[model samples]
Target: MNYITCSQGHKSTGGSNFCSTCGEPLQNSNHYLEPTLIGIQPGTRLRDRYIVREMLGQGGFGRTYIAEDTGRFNEKVAIKEFIPSVQGTGALNKAVELFQREAVTLYQLQHSQIPRFWEAFQENSRLFLVEDFIEGRTYESLLNERLRQGRCFSEPEITKLFQDLLPVLSYLHNQGVIHRDISPDNIILSGKTGLPILIDMGAVKQVTVNVATNLQTTSAPRGTSIGKVGYAPDEQIRLGIVAPNSDLYALAVTAIVLMTGKQPEQLLDQYTLTWKWDREINLSLLMTQVLNRMLAPRGDQRFQSADEILSFLGLRQTNPAYSTPNYSGNSTPIYQNPAYSTPNYSGNSAPIYQNPVYPTPNYSGNSAPSPVNNSGCGQIFDASIPVPQEIKGWNWGAFLFGAFWSVGNKVWIGLLCFIPYVGLIMAIILGIKGNEWAWKSRRWASIEAFKANQKTWAVVSLCLTGFVFVIVFLASLGGS
Candidate 1:
């Protein structure tokens, strides 16, 4: 088989970087040759195994084909062809190196969310890499289809997409691999399950070397940006700095576009201001907040890692009900247990070395430990409620109210003992940490806090009852 000449009319002087006639870099022009079967062949095969069927797609650097491997019982595989320039002494060698690199990169990745690479070989002066054929539409197709149908996806649906890809992105980042190009076109949706499989690793960068990382972070060469312009993060475009968080930013944009059925460009133009869309989707506040954080204009403003976004969404955190309070936002829950206060560890007393001081403590003891005595002040709670880490970020105003109530209970403890039912009610109110104090264990704490006030409450109740009886008797005599 003869190597095809480029459009420059220069025949590929086998394995050269530039053409001998025009001095311009020459590529194999016969890349459009479809793969033929073993039984029906016009020419002898390169390895006598793969029979080219037809060209699937082509890019600036390579082309993909749907081919049948005769040696493997005629199984189908997608083959990528890399055309080496006919100029430099080792032009073909460099092209083969890149082909091998792509094969190796794909082989190392074994996640269910990524496509699998099969084999690589050089045929008829052209380098080709074979991979498993995914019979699915790209995410770009799905978005267009939804838009044509005048429909949009819900937040839950979008969350399922992110949840599947989050772990994959984390894996790539941990391995120091960055998919510099992350966009709808690069994402393939499984036609059978509607799940996504990330494809195209030619643009992936391995930043294991410090020199490569520094160079990429400083200046990105022209024509290197393969990601959709709107979906690509600014840092990735301006600087070749591709990080795990950058992929997350693109995913967030993808989610927004999928949920609203809007084009990425339109969304980017309107991103600076508030957006009102025609679609209706039931999205949780937590999901929306995480998405916005991921799509923040600056990379620093976005989540530091994929795990951070997952934590904010309450997905990666082990506790199903453990919710973090909003320190910088207004939607935080207001927990009020009037009978208890968070202990002041910042005071002159040496701080208690609780393992998870602000977070939920791991209780390994036989029983729940008693509250520490800070003279007379201590945190009180109902024995039943589980305390979480978010409680540490609670408002101190509630704690102040509990402190005053505790003092009042100590001074008037005896008053609560005299009035029978009234005295009992007062004691219970003072002892139990109710909604007013944000105490999780309000019942137990309330009983202990107001023990001294019970007697005072009882005497006051008895006096009020006697006075009411005397008044009633006098009124009856006057009427007679």
Candidate 2:
């Protein structure tokens, strides 16, 4: 029968041996199965070792399987089946190349976080790669579990998580390897190791030609633009350049999601309005500030290296405790509620006064004698009163009238300028200086004419509007 049911329990039928829909083997029976090896079947064992068990997951490019080794080996492995495209010859060839290249890249990797690659071979035109099977959950699963508990991850949990990932990225960057895809799902939590193991180096590329033997370097950078959309940085989404800082940007977004238990999309919208650290997070202020900077829209504004982030976290370098001075009347920390109050300058003592010295007056002259010490109810000149200065400019009444006059003149100038053809050019020139000449001069002249009447200000907005209309009219007529 040229038909088979996928591990997803979906039925597929076609001429090609691979499942027409999911690209799995079409042979569904046993005993008389098409091919066989060591109690297993053919079209199943790629390198005569890995035994294809069942499907774990599938994406647009490839399908992952939970397979086991049967050839003198008893270990579970993940077989990533890269099915050649039956549609286009060019695409089939390119997919095959990418599959082989990815295997080679994985083979060259030497990090504990990265899965170890065993072998790469073909089974009836279908490429399969065997890699270490990470047993546990993905970061996405962990996030969901945290959410289900009605609790969000704490800052320390997030910091420890990223701190562990930073070394992996730092190592890759030093080797000129850009992961190109750093999302929560790609990060697998290893139950045995109790740490995140970065998986699926299929999209990984060597921007530098260090270990890659058959590397293809183009004027274009040698990494995939295929990253988780929301977590992907703006540059990576818009332009396909994969720099080390790009990873930092994604990691920052991941950290935010982990801390807030919010999807990247929700956080991104809030971030567009204004990005700031979660007040609930208890990490160092500098570290939070650094994460905020990492998510900056402009890549140039972001930090250059993971080491910078590490240093800000007080891991790679020493960061001095910077205490800001208290600006509020309270001297307590700004983070505190109902900030502390400043101490009063005076204690409980009332202010004391000195005895006054009065000027003696000539009683014999027409001038009255200065009052004697008035302790006994004699009339007293108000000692606490302040004397007003004499107005040097025009009186307040005169100043007000002059302002009214100047405003009237401004209106007249506007009416005159609104005459039509000549008005446009005249308005253009005077519009440039309308406030500078007419309205401003009135205010200046008013201030000059009446210091006491300085409080009286001519509302120049009406004058300015009138002046603009006049100038426009003049320009229109002049053009005609």
Candidate 1 local lDDT, 285-376, one digit each (tens): 46644665676655555665565667667666322232222233322112111001122223233212111212212233244323221111
- Model 2 TM-score relative to the real fold: 0.54
Q: What Cα-based lDDT does every candidate model obtain?
A: 0.51, 0.52
lDDT of 2 by residue, 381-468 (tens): 3333211232222222222233343344342343434456755554454443333233222211122333322333333444555788
Model 1 quality (TM-score): 0.52
- TM-score to true structure, per model: 0.52, 0.54
